[model samples]
Target chain A: MSLADLTIAEAGKQLRSGQATSVDLLEAVIERASFTEAQLHCYLTIDHEGARKAAESADRELAAGTDRGPLHGIPLALKDNFCTRGMTTTCSSQILAGYVPPYDATVVSRLRSGGAVIVGKTNLDEFAMGSSTENSAFGPTRNPWDPERVPGGSSGGSAAAVAVGSALGGFGSDTGGSIRQPASLCGVVGFKPTYGLVSRYGLVAFASSLDQIGPLARNVGDALTLFEAVAGHDPLDSTSYPGPVPEMRSDLEAGPKGIRVGVVTELSGEGYEPAVSTAMAEMLNRLAADGAELVEVSLPTFELALSCYYLIAPAEASANLARFDGVRYGLRVDGETVEEMMARTRAEGFGPEVIRRILLGTYSLSAGYYDAFYGQANRLRTKLIREIAEVHERVDVLVSPTSPTVAFELGAKTQDPLAMYLSDVCTIPADLAGTPAISVPVGLDHQGLPIGLQVMAPALGEAVMFRMARAVEERAGFTARPAMAGLPT
Target chain B: MPIEIDIAHVARLARLALTPDELDRYRSQLAVILDHAARVQAVDTTGLAPTAHPLGLSNVFRPDEVRPPLDVDEVLSQAPSARDGYFEVPPALEGA
Candidate 1:
């Protein structure tokens, strides 16, 4: 089998057994990354020399009888938002287009310490603000399933890179549905752990409260492996989890034999394409056939999740993004006066969607509207969390369609922002309630596009979610490769 | 309610400016945005407390401590404009 066909987990075993050297694996990945980047537009920067050096060091360590476990010699990619020392970490925005961090994000530090080879930095929506990669200042990432369709956003490039076998796995950030949505569109496994399970320091905050860094991999096992390496507490991130996470890999293999799966009634569908709904149903049937009990649960507050998210996320974003004023780090446009410079700089720096959110957020926090908008959204959020918690008491996992439909054509809904926002409705509630959720590719739509099945569990219950996801992934048997054949046009 | 969006006011607040035509465009677009957002006004939130965070995590803070400073030259490398040990920018106030 080709090196590209091996998941990170499988490749690690082979590398440790002397079946393949790190140099061999890195060469394959580097070639794939270069080939796929042109057609797929997946990466913002390819760390060819860095990856080679890391791979060489790993080989030396292996030769010296030192092993760094499952991640040793495994090649991977990172979403552009994560900081990498001495590497340009543009969050796909012109504002920080040329800025390189002097330090690494905690996740990057952990992954490197775990011996994972960093292949490249993937493209993303400008500051991770959009559902489609189309909002990227660089350009939209085409869906590996169908070139005309979008590979879902913010983490679209990361998902696309993994789907095309350019990297064994990629790091993606989830705010709303960034990771899951793209995983669904691109036919891969995406996992968002419970909030605080992953560190957010140096992640280039979009909406600090909702953003989470997670993994997009070829399978559930790969996702589990990467998650185990990255999820932990860091003193640098105030939101990092202080408690220890469950042994994810061991639990994922145990399956859902005794687990009770809940199908969220509200998240199922009205606007969801029939193919995706069918795929979700097929997974539920498979789970039932596997001796898992399926129960229908109600989260009545789900209908309000998107509404609550828009208000809360933007409100936080308005505050978080304020640090980008010309006085601090970021692009600055010069004007005759300081105030004029600040105005001109931000005007040129931020995109329309970002500006709209900032304005809405600022207004929502204003005296009159604070109680009306942000206040009400917070109340709705509490109700939603309570409902999710109540449902989790009866079920080990909750299932839904990751998104309403398959990838849409590029620029298809740019004129209708509401239509684009609705794509995240099913996935956003998990973020709102701080739950662990995953999107695993299940089947293909009528047009041969990929569809994703979502599984969610209560906070810190990622193992349960992954267990269900593994079952669906094994049964659904999705093997759609990127249309570009691992090379850019 | 503010019948029309004050483009200059919003632009100043957002650190942006709009031309007359762009102002007209944003006025119309922002109205639709507000119209859609107005749906939040109808939900009844009486007796419910506003949740600042979903995690129920409170007082999540780090101890304030001094750390080693960045190499001044490295820190200043990307600065658009800088003076000795400080970043230089125009100003925050309108007429400062």
Candidate 2:
């Protein structure tokens, strides 16, 4: 009934049919953000002036007989790591507290060109280094389901904004499940496309090999729409897929009938919470009822992913983040010499988690330990890839709980790094393999928090992945909204 | 068991200046994380080439034609200190 409740496709139809104006949609977004921002902390900044101007221009364009597709005039958010010409792009880190990019990232430019109204930028963990948003230099973004709990990270703000209706849909960079884990915790749809499927030209690098820009939206169909607008090769990013992006169709009413789904044996019931496991078991039963052929598939390499990721990601981060020295841009501290000033600036600018990662990375790449840590992780990565590829030969798509548990309290696992890392155990395997995966809200936990089912497909297999995700979305019939939406402002 | 290593030495190599208090905290934290990640060594990677990248792309080359570059003035303006459209930093090869 509410303006924010309408999916992007529905809202686009209304805009084209003269039922709702772009201004009306913009107002709905602002009102929702104002009501919930204090409790949810979903955004790092809200560009009211820019968004209002963009909405007005979109209205003018449509009235003048030019249409820009589903996102035309619809309010959408981008996670802060993406460069947005003049908008401040802080990766929830103090090092670049007020830094603004001089040029737009490839994705940002594409969305702008598509006539989407840019609402604002969302927060992320400091350089996307943590599983919990608690690692952000700014305070953690709270879950919309319950304000005391984390929304998940490093794309937590994007997930929270979408869940709470602060934005219709948003784009987030997923490196090690930054997008999906948050989407799972916040009860929304998040898709991490296969590696090389999207350009990362202006995304602040975390792990260059693993980072990907994708969509977080209300449901599977909406996620596919957003992904289509941004996916494809970009000449600016040499790592982008050199071939034409595969055609993706949006007619996704297909059920999981006759599809062979692999239930990852390593991730099923053992480490997941009872509430989460119950929902997962129920999800499998529903899939089976919908004519999906469910079979147990083992990906033993799953156990090595978490460990391998920590080393490989941090090691790459140490190098990618070295560009933030005091010389070129961002925070600078005074010292007697260049190196001292650089060191002091970094020491003062970076948060504890960032420092911990840099040290770990440096130590791994150090002369005495290169063969022991970073090198070993790379070799193991190859082995992991091969083993995962072997399993994918049998199943059309693999399924698992997106996260091991529901949204936990803000400080629940922050003190213990290992405990915090375990939250991402289910999601990291797909990231390591550079394959496509999506998280769909399957059902709710006993505490009434949302649970997500992850659908994974082989490299460049997004068509099948989206089909299965849509099937799960339809069968689960998860229509419950977070109680935060009903609370008084 | 936590393995032995010097946190201070690693910090210095990374060009990070950490206080004694921070070093003590990191020493314990890094030890635990490293010990956990050590499991990577147990993975049987025999006969497999190291995977530095998932896509396995090498030396991606673009056309030699010149393209528009970022504005120097705009980039320098965002730096902490700039002089005559150049980023200003302390003299290198001196200080720690």
Candidate 3:
């Protein structure tokens, strides 16, 4: 196989056995990325010089008996929202067009320490606001499977890059299925670790409480490898769990035999695409045939998750984003007074979706409306959490389709924000409960787009999630590559 | 349905300067979204406590010790208007 097509584990084996140098692997990926950039628009910035330098240093270290484990010299991509020292972290918004961070985010620092060579920062919805990357200030990232369709987002670029073999694995933050939904659309493995399992320090806040940094990779094993490297406590983020990080890669080969899996009854049928439902049904059957017991489970509050998320995420976002008022940093426009300047700058800087959310949030949190909107949403959230916890008592993990549909055509749902929000219907509950869930490609839709089977586990239940995900990966045998994968280097 | 005037009020509260056309557009769109979001109210959360955070964490205090901060020059470098390591902004007073 070409160097660009190697998974993290495969590339690591090659690097260790003296079969391929890091420089060679890096060059192959750079070539492929350059060739595919015109069609995919997957990245905001490609750090060619920085990656080449890092790869050379990695080669020197490997030859001199200094190794940085599996990630050493592995070419990876980061979602642009992660702060990279001296690199522009625009979050795909014009407001921070030329803004560069003086320090690296904790996840970026951790990846670098593991010797992972970051090739570029991938694009996302402006401030991670939308399910479809169409909300990106830059043009929407095209699905590699079909150029006319969107790569599901706000982590669309990261998922597209990994699917097209531009990067072995990439990092993306999941606020509400941004990572997993895109991963599902792009036929890749996207895992959102438990909320506190991965530190959120330096991730540009989009609903701080719901945001989490996770991995997008070609397979479950590669996803686990990347997850382990970044999942641990960081004192910088007070919400980070102080407990020991679980060894996700230790028991990958173990099958999901005798494991109790709950098929969330509410998530299936009606509103889900017919093809996606079929793929999900086949996956459940396969799991049942493989010695796994499937029990039908229902979280009555599941239907209310999307409604609650819109209120809570936007409310937090409005408060968190108040920091970008053009005084301390980012785009600034002159006005007669400070308030006018702040308003004018924000007017010119933010996109429609962002502004819409801000307005919605401001209204919801306003004095009189708070008790009805934001307050009620929080109460519903509590009920949802309790319902999910009750369901977990009966099943080890909950399963559903990651997204309700496959990659939808660009501009299909952009006109209707509510329709766009429906794309995350199946995946938002996990974020609401702050649980670990993974999306693994199980089959293809009639349109040839990928369908993802979502495996959700309770907080800190990544081990079970991984085992179930691995089993799905093995059974599905979904080796179909995107048509864009054939682009010549 | 949200009144058009209410949309402008919310925009002002958000510190966003929206054009009249945008105000009209958002007034209708936001009403749709708010109507959809209103579905949560029917769930009967009367006795349930609100969960601002899923983790139930509160008062996450850290040691009050001095730590190295970002360089002033580096921080100012990103500002659109910087003067003597300070962010320059519009005058607070109308004519000052």
Candidate 4:
């Protein structure tokens, strides 16, 4: 088998057995990237020389008995939003024209320490504001399943890179459904850990309260390994969870024999495409057949999750993004005065969708509208969190389709912003309540596009979440690879 | 009450100088979004505290200790325009 086909665990075994070197894994992914990148556009930058040097060092170290565990010498991609020292970190927006950080984000530091090879930075929606990566200033990342369809965003590029086999896994930040939605559409596994479980120090802030970084991988185990590498407390991030990171590797192989899988009643029927619903039903049946007890549970306030998210996230974004004026780093447009320069720079730097969201945030937080808009949304968030917690008291985890439909054609919903936002319905509840959730490929729809089943767990409930996800992964037997992967296997 | 979205005013508050066409386009689009968002207004969340974050945790503080800061030259090098170790900008006091 080609080196690119190996999962992280399998690759680690190869490295340990002296059968394959780190350079061999890096070379395979680099070669795969050369063939697929032109068609996929998954990376903003691919550091050919830097990655080679890192892989060589990892190989040398391993020879000297300095193995850094599973991630050592493993090739991976990062979402552009994460700051990397001396590397361009644009968040895929023009506003950050040619800006490179002098310091690495805490997570980037973790990955580098873990001995992972950084292949390149992946693309996302400008400031991660849009569901479709079409909002990226550079351009949209095409779905590897079909070049015509969007690879779901704002982490589309990372998901597409993993789906196309150019990278074994890629790390992307999940705010709302950014990581999970794209993973679903691209036929891969995406996990969004419980908020605060991962530090946010170097992730470009977009709605600070909601953003959490996680991994997109070819399978559930690889995703968990990637998550384990970066999940921990950091003094740099004030919100980083102080509790010990829950141990999950031991429980991954366990079956969900008596796990109460909550089938979210509100997430069922209506709005979902018939094909998607059919795939979801089949996945549920497979889980039931595998010994998981499925129970019907309702989160009534889930209907308001989208609206609440729109208000709360953008309000925080307007405040967080205000730092990108003309005076600081990034794009600058001179004017007669500093105030004029700041206004003109922002107008030119931010895109239409970004500008719209910023304005919405401003209007919502403006005097007289605060109580009616931002205040009301924040309260709704509290209610949503409470409902999710209450339901989890009975069920170990919640199950739903990752997205309402499979990958849709690019430009399908870009015109109507609301239509684009509606795509994240199934994934938003977990984000609102700050719980752990994952999207695992279950089966494919009639169009042959992959369908994802999302499993959500209460805060810090990694053990149960991984158990159910592994159960789904084993039961689904979803072996259909994207024809566009086009790898020489 | 349906909001009369003043796109221009909101843009000014947001420090974005939108063109007239963008202003017109966003006015209608944002109205539709806000109209949908009005659902939250109908429900009275009496006494429910706003969730600043889902973890029910407040802000954290680092130890108040003196430490070396980033290099001044390196920080200044990234500014749009800097002069003699100071960031250069247009007139800040407007008329002055």
Among these predictions, the greatest DockQ belongs to 4
Report the C-alpha displacement of residue A463, candidate 4, in angstroms: 1.0
TM-score of chain B of 3: 0.87
lDDT of 2: 0.88
- Residues B1-96, candidate 3: write the lDDT tens digits: 442338878888899998999998988887888888878877788799998567787677677889999999999888888897788888888778
Candidate closer to the true structure by TM-score (higher is better), 1 or 3: 3
> Which portions of model 3 show Cα errors greater than 4 Å?
B1-5
Error of 4 at B93 (Å): 1.1
Query: What is the DockQ score, from 0 to 1, of model 4?
Result: 0.81
Quantify all predictions' global Cα lDDT against the true fold.
Answer: 0.84, 0.88, 0.90, 0.89
lDDT for model 1, on a 0 to 1 scale? 0.84
lDDT of 1 by residue, A139-203 (tens): 77888777888999879999988988888899999999999999999999999889988999889
lDDT of 1 at A110: 92
Cα-based RMSD of candidate 3 = 1.4
Residue A244 C-alpha lDDT in model 3: 87
- How many residue pairs of model 2 clash at the backbone? 0
CAPRI classification of candidate 3:
medium
Chain A TM-score of model 4 comes to: 0.98
Tens-place lDDT per residue, model 2, A1-489, is 568777899899999999998888989988888888988888998999999999999999999999988889999989999998889988999999999899999999999999998899998889988877888887888999988889999899999999988899999988899999999999999999999889999999999889999999998889998998888888889888887776657536677898899998889667788988888888889889879999899888788889998998888898888887888888999988889999999999999889888988888888888878888888888887887788777888999999999999989988998898888998898888898999999888878899998999888888888889998898889888887854443
Question: Which portions of model 2 show Cα errors greater than 4 Å?
Answer: A485-489
Candidate 1, residues B18-77: lDDT per residue as tens digits? 566765666676676666666666777777787766677777777789988657777787
Q: What is the lDDT ranking, best to worst?
A: 3, 4, 2, 1
Q: Which runs of model 1 end up more than 4 angstroms from their true locations? A: A483-489, B1-4, B63-66, B91-96
